[model samples]
Target: MAALRTKIIACPTVGEELRSLLPDGFVLEMLAYGLHNVPENLHAQLQASIDATGPEFGTILLGYGLCANAILGLNSRRFRLVIPRADDCITLFLGSRREYLRQLSLAPGTFFLTKGWIECGEDPYTEYCALRTRYGHEKAHKITRRYIQNYTRLALIDSGSYESEAYRKYARMVADYFDLTFEEIPGSNELLGKLLSGEWDKGFAVIPPGQVVARDLFYGPEGMP
Candidate 1:
């Protein structure tokens, strides 16, 4: 049988990483970063994008994780869907589920940041600034504190896809402002490289046409419903 024609539909949150390693000939479509704020909306947008994709493409690569179960129940009547087996994009940045789990174990209260996140202005710090503009500084500080009360650290994942000086400065400022420990973690593009190279292996979920994405695909036999 002939190889399938593949296209990638990804969240803009990982746009830089994807572009850095993307192979030739594959078209990449990046959705808006704001969709992640609402899982339901993200799910709806993904399903719509899949359903509306041209039939010329036989497979669609989703550059997303379970994403708060946003990808769950997504189905394509005309194409196969390929997704990374990750709880979130942070796993992709870290390069594997094991690494992501390890980081979680080390710092369960960490709030992770990446270049894309900083560039998109979606982090808590950005929200705090916006709130400070409308509300007073004291109120914004209280609100921001409430939002990150449980977070004890701010971890910036350095993927090396781009320079980190400016982003690092911003992350540190946010960390200092919130009185959280600041740390920079080395990131990898191994999993993303594999995804773009069709190295499905056990790290990816390759859903067949008409099949819905399920928790088990990402979490294995012991997956929770």
Candidate 2:
């Protein structure tokens, strides 16, 4: 028997709340590191955390495109990245709703708001690749290889073939990043059905790693807003 470990990341506001709802006996942490961009110190801290945690699985849950770049480059073998079925573009765009909407002129109805949240409109993998490119292809490839080595699996939850073009782009990116092994779990209607079918030992969901239940922790009266 092995211990289950997971990393649940969400909006800066919701990380604490999500941590509270997690099951006991599993090592859990929130991705709340603050820095404008990838910094050496932050990377070292991340390395230290990985070494200290020593969990068999690492799951990432937020969609702001902030940690994806860093997470893919971590030097660990038990890492897994999970994103909600909604397109990453929505998450990226909404990182700064006012600015994103003003620049892109995105209508609120884009992608029908998966799980009742805005989309960021970027491919997780492509963006990751871009980050790698910034560092240099060889370095990026090396880091990505390391990331894959540690990454047990990558999955996309709350996804379905019946999504908008934007969401489809997200699906494609997840596939490309993990070589298309991403699973499309229904977010609204048949979420439970999909979870019951999968056998993820150390699962991670963007909203609720391996679950299609997307809750708003950053907005509304109860949300952070």
Best by lDDT: 1
* Alpha-carbon RMSD, candidate 1: 2.1
CA lDDT of each candidate? 0.89, 0.39
Top candidate by TM-score: 1
Error of 1 at 135 (Å): 1.4
For 1-225, candidate 2 gives per-residue lDDT tens digits of 775555543443223223334555444454443431454544455555655544555553333232333333444345544433322233332332233344234222222223222133233354457767589777776665555543333333333323455554566455555553443333322222222223322222323323332333222233321
lDDT of 1 by residue, 40-112 (tens): 9999999999988886788899999888999999999889898988888999999988888899899999999
Q: TM-scores of the models, in the given order?
A: 0.94, 0.32
- Candidate 2, overall lDDT? 0.39
* Clash number for each model: 0, 15
